[model samples]
Target: MADTSPSEAGNAPLDQMGLDNFAPYLMNRIMGRYNAALSAEMAALGLTTPQMRSLAVLSVTDGILIRELAVYAVVQQSTLSRALDALVRDGLVRRETDATDSRATRVYLT
Candidate 1:
């Protein structure tokens, strides 16, 4: 049997709590494995996580606004900007001024 009791500080030690019982820890572990596997595939394709994420979103919603793409890709705008720059340089994607909004830019897979 496992001791599930909290310590004097009113927080149970991680070992006692068991890693499998922690949702956040479990989620992080799962994501770590997923990222590791994805990293290899991305490297083979010459794509980083942000770049791949951007392409994924664009595949589903082509010509999406840059701001919206950042949200959908779950990356910071600055990171997405750099990734998009590389993608554009590599000829994987293209950026264009939004037809409806001159100030906004849209991303599309090429």
Candidate 2:
């Protein structure tokens, strides 16, 4: 006969567990669905998820540094840079170098 001990039951497969026990899993799934819906709407405006996020942040904090935008937008600098390039091309955003720090670039919504 197989050993069906109480202790062994604790190691049961995740499929047997309640999903409500995993907050991160639930949150991720919720966000995924939300982004999917929002992405479709934004796509009609010729904007991507990243671009929408950047604009949302810029709306509140215009002339924010590129590095700051990355953090606020929850996007990597390299990825945000590409999105910003497209936004600039579309005349939706303006990119300017910081006067005091030439190495830093700031972005504003146009």
lDDT of 1 by residue, 1-110 (tens): 67665775568788877888888999999999998999899999999999999998999999999999999999999999999999999999999999989999999899
TM-score winner: 2
Alpha-carbon error at 89 in model 2, in Å? 0.5
The residue pairs that clash in candidate 1, if any, are none
Worst lDDT run of 10 residues, candidate 1, spans 1-10
Tens-place lDDT per residue, model 2, 1-110, is 79885448675455656677666789999999999999999999999999999999999999999999999999999999999999999999999999999999999999
- Model 2 global lDDT (CA atoms, 0 to 1): 0.92
Model 2 TM-score on a 0 to 1 scale: 0.82
- How high is each candidate's TM-score? 0.81, 0.82
Error of 2 at 109 (Å): 0.8
What value does the lDDT take at residue 61 in candidate 1? 99
